[model samples]
Target: MHAIDVNELYHILYTKLGPRHWWPARSTEELLCGMILIQNTNYKNVDRSLANLDAATNFGLAALLALPDGQLQALIRPSGFYKNKARYLRAVLQAYHDHYHELAALPTPSLRKRLRDLPGVGNETADVMLLYVFMRPAFVADSYSRRLFARLGQDAPYPQLQAHIAPTMRLNIAQAQEFHALLDDYGKLGPDVFGLADQYQLKL
Candidate 1:
């Protein structure tokens, strides 16, 4: 798809969905924690897990760091992949505790690299943390984003797609975060807003 068309799609989606208020978190640390827990999981489940923790404890970095692994696993069970996700979370938290000593002191690039280096944290997860928590300019590409782009006839693979789009968007960190939130909201609300499936016919 042409860059103009991509931008048009973004505009249409944004107009339809408005602001998504995504990556819902009570604090920066919670946002980062949610990003790690949310891999391979739905937002609803992640919310449930976060609420579970919030209701029972302080839900701060210190509390999370002090919590036993088994307890953390149990609290986040709703997000699924509890055991592996818990291990990944612990590794990330430990890295923060050891190096930064406080979440605010963690440099964005350094924290992002460290997160990407940890097991179970990939580009998407790392970018989520960077964008939502660190307020960095990082675009996230996932399955729904790929499907949307493919439908619009862009042929790049996921990684290349991100690289191709990020520069073209010309958005700063805050704008990138808003752009991603808008795209995700579109995927969730597309059928209802477009009504294209029933209005048009496709050979494929």
Candidate 2:
């Protein structure tokens, strides 16, 4: 097997799928809220949950802080894990002011560490937020990413997968964001079963 060129994959997907327009956040606060809401859930459910929150609290940070836990849980029920998610969202809100700031003011490593220290933020989540929301150079290694890379004979641990893409590409914010989105959309649009082309152009 040959090595999978990360940039080649990125370009292939970009050319095939065009723009996926991912992350789906209009503001920094919205992105932070989505970071908590999107845990272990799909975008459809997250969109519904966000709509509920928007209608209920106008997506205001103070309103989110003011909303009772039970109410918060109810509003975000569409995304699942409502109770834990509510707590996680609040914890993120508590930390956002301190750890999050203008992108120019903070380094990627420090911001990533601070985000990871917060509850409910694992490696994948931290990297996603860094890459999409903070516009940093972090390759988000999700399950789809691993599966795609593995097919190309680049099987590795999560951090290793990130490393594999990080050095050669050094992808900027737009490219990194588009690459992640393309991987996810391609995985979903590709065949459900593995080891087969199944109407998709993604070669193994």
Candidate 3:
């Protein structure tokens, strides 16, 4: 496996795919709910679940929190794991609403810690919230990124990979968010699309 230049790869993906405008949420509450509902499911399911939720709550976290477990579960049933996710959603959103102001005051590291402390927010989910929701510079070591780099022959643990890419790839919040989106979008494409099977030897 050859060494991959993180910045160079970012440029390649950006030039090829252009702007992704990702996270695909109109509000922070929707984004957070999507981030949780997205676990163990595809975006299709998440979108359907988000629609159901939006119709019910208009993307209000407080409204979502007010829903009974069964009702919430039914709304998000399309996302799969509805029972567990409903519980997680209630717990996390309650914490988010109660600590909303306090979270805004936290420095990035502390903020990430606080997010991770929420019931369903894992490292990747915390990073997503940090980057997209909190508008912080965070490298999300999500599955897409892991797969992309591993195929490029530079596999590493989540923290190590994130640390490796963050400095060079995450110049600021906007760039970080774009870079992450590009990686995921590229990962979703056919391997032949980017010639990643040959370790990113460009076809065009």
Best by lDDT: 3
What lDDT does candidate 2 reach at residue 158? Answer: 89
Superposition-based RMSD of candidate 3 using all C-alpha atoms, in angstroms: 3.4
lDDT of each: 0.71, 0.77, 0.81
**Candidate 2 residue pairs in backbone clash:** none
Residues 31-141 of candidate 3: C-alpha lDDT, one tens digit per residue: 888989999999899999999999999988768888888899999999998998988888778877888789979998789888888888888988998888788878888
Q: Report the C-alpha lDDT of model 2 over 74-131, residue by residue, as the tens digit.
A: 9999999999999988887767654455433677777777778889888888898788
Candidate 2, superposed: residue stretches over 4 Å from native: 1-4, 102-104, 192-204
Which stretches of model 1 miss by more than 4 angstroms? 1-9, 100-112, 190-204
Q: Rank the candidates by TM-score, best first.
A: 3, 2, 1
Listed in order, each prediction's TM-score against the native is 0.80, 0.85, 0.88
Model 3 TM-score? Answer: 0.88
Worst 10 residues of 2 by lDDT: 195-204
